[model samples]
Target chain A: DVKVTQSSRYLVKRTGEKVFLECVQDMDHENMFWYRQDPGLGLRLIYFSYDVKMKEKGDIPEGYSVSREKKERFSLILESASTNQTSMYLCASSPNRGGGNTDTQYFGPGTRLTVL
Target chain B: GQQVMQIPQYQHVQEGEDFTTYCNSSTTLSNIQWYKQRPGGHPVFLIQLVKSGEVKKQKRLTFQFGEAKKNSSLHITATQTTDVGTYFCAYGQNFVFGPGTRLSVLP
Candidate 1:
């Protein structure tokens, strides 16, 4: 079974505070993604990484950044937390970028962040 | 930009009732995938449709991919409480997800 673990299940942060959400996958996957899910907005991509030290901006990358120092771990960083940034954050990893078929993604439990 | 859209944002149904959700993409998709997310849980991969005008079934659930590769639908026959959650269609070259349709099954 593929297991993806996140650093926190629920987090509360004050405005202007920096926050870090960590994700680690045991499958040694090459692609990782971070998304924020809102009520009606669904899941909006924040950032993604295809390899170590290689990152790509998703649809919504502003106010969020990602780091992948190792192959199995990816971290999403919020430079400054704000009220509008509070949402359910999800992390996912895939085996490779379209090796044969690559739409399947394994996801972490997700972190619910509240910016106060 | 590649985008996916789902209809009927929320659906409430009694046990044994049928439920269906539609997904439409703004651009042609290379392939489409379906995911289920239980309330308060992360999304889980369900199935993927690669060919145009292909239909796949998993027990009580049926999935269809449009011939144009621009639309898909998920139909549940005799939905149960276990089916309660959100259904999302993920498309695009990188799998951009739709808004999702929340399903509520009443016992």
Candidate 2:
């Protein structure tokens, strides 16, 4: 089974602090994504990496960034934590796919962050 | 920009009752995927529909893709306590997801 794991299940941080959320997938997937889920807002993508060192900005990319240095690991970084940034963060990985393939995504247990 | 929307922001039903959620996309989709996220849990992929006017079933759940490829629906034959969760519809070339629907089942 494909296993996606996140570093933290819950976290609390002070404002202005730099934070790092790590995600690793055991399966050799080519695509990795980071999304933040807020009440009523749904899962808004922050960043996605299709390959090592390649990244793309999603709908809500501000206040967040991502790094994909290896095939199995993706990291989400918060340059400066703020109260408004508190929410549930999810990481997902999917195998490479062409048009029409299902390429279903496997998600990791989310990390709920609270910025004070 | 593509938009995906799900109706019935929230639904409450008794056990053994039927439940359904509808999803509409602004632009025709190449494919549509459905996901379920239980309370306090991450979302999990349920099914994906590709062909226009396609319908698929998984035990008690039925998924249908509209003929125009711009809408989809998921219907549960009988609501169970375990079926409680938020159902999300994802579309677009980039798999942009709809806001999702929260379902509550009363036993």
Candidate 3:
């Protein structure tokens, strides 16, 4: 089975503190994504990386950045965390861009970040 | 921007009853995918539909992609406690998920 693992299940940070949420996939997928889940708002994309050392901003990439130094790992970083940034952060990976038949997206358990 | 929306953000149903959720996209999608995320768990892929007006079934669940490839639906034949979760429909490149329908199955 494809496995996606996040570094932390729960994290708390003070305002203005830097935070990092790490995600690692064992399937060697080429695409990785980070999203924040909120009630009623749904899953909003924060950032995504298609290849190592490459990243792109997503719909809600205001205070978030991502890094992909290795094919199996993707990291989401918050330069200066704010209370509004508290959310359930999710990480996902797919074999490739779902252009043909890449429908499946394996996800990690998620990190619930509490920016106080 | 490619966007998708799901209707009836929350649904409450009794066990043994049926439930259905709808997803609509702003643009024509190449394909549509369905996913289920249990409470406090990550999302898991359920099924995918490619062709226009395509229909696929998995056990008690039925998934359909509209003829316009801009809408889709997921119907569960008989609701069960285990069926309680958020159902998400995504359509676009790299499988973008919608807001999701949170289903509460009451015993």
Candidate 4:
């Protein structure tokens, strides 16, 4: 079974504080993604990394950044947490099959962050 | 960028009732994938359809792709409380996901 784990299940941060969310996948997938799920809005992609040290901005990347120093781990960073940034953050990974099509993505349990 | 739309943003059904959700796209889709996300959990892959007018079934769940390749539907028969969750349809290489249909099965 593919297992994806997140650093925190729930987190609380003060406004203007920096927050970090980490994710690790044991399946050795080459593509990783970060998304923030909100009510009504659904899951909005924040950022994605296709390889180590390579990242791409997704639809909503204004307030978030991502890092992938190793193939097995990905991290999401909030430079300065704000009330609007509080949401359920999810991390997912998929194996690259050499096609443009995205395969099934295995997701972590998710991290719920609250910016106070 | 590709996009998919889901209808009936929310649905509430009694146990043993049938439920269905639709996913539509303005343009022809190469393939469509369905996912189920239980409350407080992550989305999990359910099935994928590529051929036009393809129909696939998993026990009580039936998924159908349109002949035009622009739409798809997921139908659940005799939905149980375990069937409660958000169902999403995604397409394209970027995997643009639909807003999802939240299902609530009442006992």
Q: Number of the top candidate by TM-score?
A: 2
lDDT of 4 at B48: 89
Clashing pairs in 4: none
Give the Cα error of residue B72 in candidate 2, in Å.
0.2
Could you give candidate 1's per-residue lDDT for residues A16-59 as a string of tens digits? 99999999999989999999999988888889988999999999
Give the winner by DockQ.
4
True contacts kept of 3: 0.65
What stretches of model 2 exceed 4 Å from their correct place? A100-102
User: Cα lDDT for residue B92, model 1?
Assistant: 57
Native-referenced DockQ of model 4: 0.76
Ranked candidates (DockQ, high to low): 4, 1, 2, 3
lDDT against true structure, model 2: 0.93
> Model 4 residue A83 lDDT?
99
Q: What would the per-residue lDDT of candidate 2 be over residues A1-116, giving only the tens digit for each residue?
A: 99999999999999999999999999999989999999999999889988999999999989998899999999999999999999999999998876646478899999999999
Q: What 10-residue stretch in candidate 1 chain B is worst by lDDT?
A: B88-97
lDDT of 2 by residue, B1-107 (tens): 77888998999999999999999988888899999999999999999999999999999999999999999999999989999999999875456789999999999
TM-score of chain B of 3: 0.96
After superposition, the stretches of candidate 1 with alpha carbons farther than 4 Å from their true spots are A97-101
DockQ for all candidate structures vs. native: 0.75, 0.71, 0.71, 0.76
lDDT of 1 by residue, B1-107 (tens): 66678999999999999999999988888889999999999999999999999999999999999999999999999999999999999975466889999999999
Q: Identify the CAPRI category of the predicted complex in candidate 3.
A: medium
